[model samples]
Target: MSVAATLSPAADVRADFPGMVTGDGAPWHYLDTAATAQKPQAVIDAMTRALGVDYATVHRGVYGRSAQMTLGYEAARRRVAEFIGAKGEDEVIFVRGATEAINLVAASWGMAQIGEGDRIVLSMLEHHSNIVPWQMVAERTGAQIDVCPLTEDGRIDLGALEAMMTPRTRLVALAHVSNVLGSVLDARAAADIAHSVGAKLLLDGCQAAPRMALDMAALGCDFYALSGHKLYGPTGIGVLWAREEILGAMPPWQGGGAMIDRVTFEKTTYAPPPQRFEAGTPIITEAIALHAAIDYVAALGPDRLLAHEAGLARQLRDELRALNSVTLFGPEESAGIVSFAIEGVHPHDLGTILDEENVAIRAGHHCAQPLMDHLGVPATARASFGLYSDENDIAALLRGIERTQRIFG
Candidate 1:
């Protein structure tokens, strides 16, 4: 049962995204989607409208436009709630990005819950965002950090994770999908393992949320984080979703304007839950654009996006494997990300060559230097697919790789 045989492509979607073309209207073969996604015209239009005609600060002014902007901003939160299957908008706290989201959880929740001798578990495949925040928190709180090993095939080893869990384990933070390898985590299993020892699970959903249909309850994770840019929306807005009670209990990480119930020189009272965490001026235009992006993705079908990209991943892997000069990474069945190293070519060299062919690929450690070390490679050339990626992009990549191989020889 091959992934390609079982899955279909998110067909004919490239046209909706304006960035798919170059200055001369030639196709731009974008394969760096795991880093960030290209925005659809719908999202751009929504953002343009929001920043122009509907521009107003939220939750402050008694003016009519301010009230409407506030309504639109809150509506965006509800839309994310609907998209991710959170209990309500109260569970979603918008931040700068997934980086900030994780840092907030680490500072607010980790500071309070984790203490001396408490263990915080993370995996080898974590993005620096996930790894660094926990490290900062652990250092401050005197918490011990435990690194969970990955399976031979690159997936997070849940069996090993379960065995590692102890009563002292206060938190287990892992990626829902590997940003480098495209290895999808069995989040429910991880969540169960974390909870078995009375620890909370935080899933970095930056890679998963765009492709997979997310349900906070179904996943059983205590917290989930995702970025708007990766979800085909604007930057400067991301989400941190926690169980309603957990978010309510977690103290505000930052303090300022809108988050306060009332502020006095003598004493300051804070707002509740999401509002308390949001602090000052929120991501107004970005949130509204995110709402539009969610609508665009929903219209395409979230579950189907995974299937489509997985098929492409299988297709690319098969083609790259045939080259024999290419050393592929990750499992055979992965989401729409393929990483490999050429026998004699540096990833950066290959990337530059591909650029001349009007093809774009990510060539670096991808901010996962630990995973790069584990894989015994300095870095890899990664081709990550989005809803707009298609066979044409793959063909262009293969052509560029062949040219690189010839030049290297």
Candidate 2:
């Protein structure tokens, strides 16, 4: 069935968010949500309450309030794990963001497993966070990095990816959705491919976590990383979900506090699965805020949220396609993002004009310079959607574009 037909009706859930309303009485059109989403009042309230009502450190302090705060922090991990359909709470470990999550795996897991004569396969659609870590690993271990190509439609070239897979392939890393093109890669299929070549897969799920349904077992990837802020939560909190066995095998990425079982003058043993990964003090309040964000998204339901965003995407894409100066990128059926370029107009200039109208959009390489090179463009304008996005927001974007053309032409 077509994704459009499969979509369910979204409830008028935008009312829960106060940021949808503009302070100056002019409606603000938020379009750079792919970079960082606006937080709902529920998330804001949760963070504020955690800090205001009872603020204390988690996992270490022996005081009563600290114990209560630790419970809250651990509860947030369970919440995030269940939200992503992870098998158990132990699978989820908190990090700074998706960037840190990838780095953790690369530094700890990748460093231990990858060696000379090994190959790490990545895709053209990967963010710099996904790409650079592997490159660093390869430089240190003498492993070769192979890139899977993108089809003309901007999806991963499955044929090229299959060909790139070899016996020496150590790890396969790819984005679940392209930050630049909004292309959704088939994680399950990619996992199958990686397994066929004896390689484990890691999905950079920052772009997909907010918009797509995730089941770690179904995806069959070794690891999946997500950012809290992009998922409508607070910053400084993210998740790295790995298979239980994989987590057991991976060495701790960082050291200091909370991750140790025994600290002696000569030797120390690390803690178990999650706490072992979570070194030092965590963002306890932010983790609570993330739980609130997950509740916010869960209450709305993924199917309904997806449908609303899909409708908005179709409308925006169709309208933009009608413009003479515009050139669209990626597949016809994309996620809640529309990337485009205007003839003789720079993306920075376009973004500046949109800002004048209080319409925010991302204008750059989207941090995937390789993908930009593949698409034969230095940079492009990208408008990403969220639950608060509406049809009026798209219309506002069109109006801003019209104004830009009038001034530039």
Candidate achieving the largest TM-score: 1
lDDT of 1 by residue, 222-264 (tens): 9999999999999999999999999889888898888889888
Q: How close is each model in CA RMSD to the real structure?
A: 1.6, 2.2
Q: Compute the lDDT of residue 19 as modeled in candidate 2.
A: 77
- TM-score, predicted candidate 1 vs. hidden true structure: 0.98
After TM-score superposition, what is the CA distance of residue 24 in candidate 2 from its true location, in Å? 1.6
Q: Which whole-number lDDT from 0 to 100 does residue 217 have in model 2?
A: 86
lDDT of each: 0.93, 0.89
Can you write out model 2's per-residue Cα lDDT over 124-222, one digit (the tens) per residue?
Answer: 878999999999999999999999989998998888888998899999999998888888888889999999989999999998899877899899899
- The CA lDDT at 401 in model 1 is 96
Which whole-number lDDT from 0 to 100 does residue 185 have in model 1? Answer: 95
Q: What ranges in model 1 sit over 4 Å off? A: 1-11
In TM-score terms, candidate 2 sits at 0.96
Which window of ten consecutive residues has the lowest lDDT sum in model 1?
1-10
Residue 266 of model 1: what lDDT?
100
